[model samples]
Target: MQIASPLINELQCGERLNHAIEHGRRGEFALLLAMLSQDARDMAQFTLGEEGTVDAKLRRQFELPPAQTLVADVADDSLVNNGGEFHELGLRGFALQQALKPEALVTRGPISVTMLDALNNTDPLCKSRYLEPQHPALPEIPHFNDRLSGQLALAQRMAQA
Candidate 1:
């Protein structure tokens, strides 16, 4: 089965949270929160083992948002759009950063390959459960190199694997 990358999982989690808020579904909200928290922990661990510290540069590269703020914002109904929805779960900035950031190790091709590897190697079953099909607000997973040519490299790696 094709598995989603961590970045995709994070984006999906954010989308689900927004969907729950829009619909006032407490159960969905709880579920999304758990997924997000778990993913964050996984990303943090992966980052630490792969890199080392959460340096300002690395944080900036990862575009790790202030988790507290992101959660609080999602919890606030007032911040939700008229449809009680927030597109992209207000995570476009972070997503872009993550997609574009260079890997710790230098490479001849795109840097996203490392991130894609990190994401693909991550447990897909755990990531996919939270990405329920009913949640329509999820961000479209971009083509590997829509913005960054690095995605192409990542795609190649995935294909090979």
Candidate 2:
């Protein structure tokens, strides 16, 4: 769908991917992952050259709003009449596409053992892989304490000035 460079990653290949989990229905996120064809996934990585993750793309493609803070164990009603909450967000199409058929692919609890394994691995397309980035390490900043001290000193100087 005209995916730009750097192809959405949250460590599924970036921190931006968490919005999907925070906003999506319990276990429903997996269905979204399945919807993305393998070729689409591969093409994304091929274009980015760094194993693309799909979260950000989905958000932008579907015109999703930013997610609010939500409980981890919230129960999903999966009912349209209850409040039309998902419909209000324009996700009815998403529900129709991913929920109506292929019943086994969508779920509400913790993913199956195999699914978890797939996500934990380096599969760029695995939604879980994006949840936790591989080889996660903080980058070093030179000067250690000097940078903070220097900034503080500069602030003090500006205050005096």
Clashing pairs in 2: 9-14, 10-14, 11-14, 12-130
- In model 2, state the lDDT of residue 16: 28
Superposed model 2: Cα runs more than 4 Å off: 1-74, 79-110, 128-161
Q: TM-score each candidate.
A: 0.21, 0.19
- Deviation in Å, model 1, residue 55 alpha carbon: 15
lDDT of each: 0.49, 0.48
lDDT of 2 at 133: 60
Candidate 1 residue spans exceeding 4 A from truth: 1-9, 37-161
Residue-level lDDT of model 1, residues 28-104, one tens digit each, is 77765664534445553354454556665577798975332222223334332222122444466545544444222
- List, residue by residue over 46-154, the lDDT tens digit for candidate 2: 5554434476677878997644322221244542232254556567755664444322333343334455555555444345334446323222344658888999999
How close to the true structure is residue 158 of candidate 1, measured as C-alpha lDDT? 98
